[model samples]
Target: MSDLPPPPRLPVTFRPGHTRAILLTAGVVIFLVISGIAMLLEHLGPGSRLSFILTGALIFWALAQLARVKVVADESGVTVVNIAGKRRLAWAEIVRVNLRPGDPWVFLDLSDGTSLPALGIQPGIAKQRAIADARALRALAEAHSASSALPHEPRS
Candidate 1:
């Protein structure tokens, strides 16, 4: 059998730029056309359209993870996130980096008694993204300080 964390159930691969697998491509295109017409008509402009606005907002949130979103896994534990804000936990401190299908975000339950979110691709685009992230996390944890912690350690 393979040694890796049994291979994340929903392994995903992330790409560069504003490339998001979760963003509903069809919906986005439709909204853009509608919003464009609304803007041309001066009906409070495209920004006033709720769907377009919401989609743009969600896209921005995903893109936020573009630069630093990375994943690393080793025998001990796995860490995934962008450097801007991150949660690093050793296996001892991790309950688990959940790999269930249909889960919203990659999660980390730290020894410090907190749950942090990882930058996981939306459901449709999880496999390649997860693999890429897992590789990065593995390398990082191996190179950096091993988190000296236990699974249920109390936070200071």
Candidate 2:
């Protein structure tokens, strides 16, 4: 059987493209509609109007968090940015990348025996893309750890 191609070059980033697009798009539409309704309500007082606008802003902010989730891989390590926080993990620290069936997103099994949720690679709207990204990341981690294990020859 033919071997799979090497992982993509470093400095690569994986994100849920469709998820982000939908979230941001929906946020904008919801915000606009909410703000418009607030302004159109002639009976509402200024305080209520401002509160309505603020509510819209808050909703947009919340959605922005999910839309910003991403996984970035560079020479040093991989950075996972989720809805609430970000974490950096060296290639050697990542023992495995898993995307099992019915999983909401990729999960990274670490050398420390911890499993981290990689929300950046969700199988929503694009299952194939998520699978490809997870495999590529797994390959990169394996390749990096293997290279690091090799003993270097002494300089002449």
lDDT of each: 0.49, 0.93
lDDT of 2: 0.93
Q: For each candidate, what TM-score against the reference?
A: 0.40, 0.95
Q: Which stretches of candidate 1 lie over 4 Å from their true place?
A: 1-32, 39-96, 121-123, 142-156
Candidate 2 ranges beyond 4 A from true positions = 1-3, 154-156
Looking at model 1, residue 127 earns an lDDT score of 63
Across 88-124, the per-residue lDDT of candidate 1 in tens digits comes to 4565665444435665545555657787766643233
TM-score: which candidate is best? Answer: 2
- Candidate 2 lDDT over 1-156, as tens digits, reads 215459899899999999999999999998999999999999999999999999999999999988999999999999999999999999989988899999999999999999999999999899999999998988888888888889999999
TM-score of decoy 2: 0.95
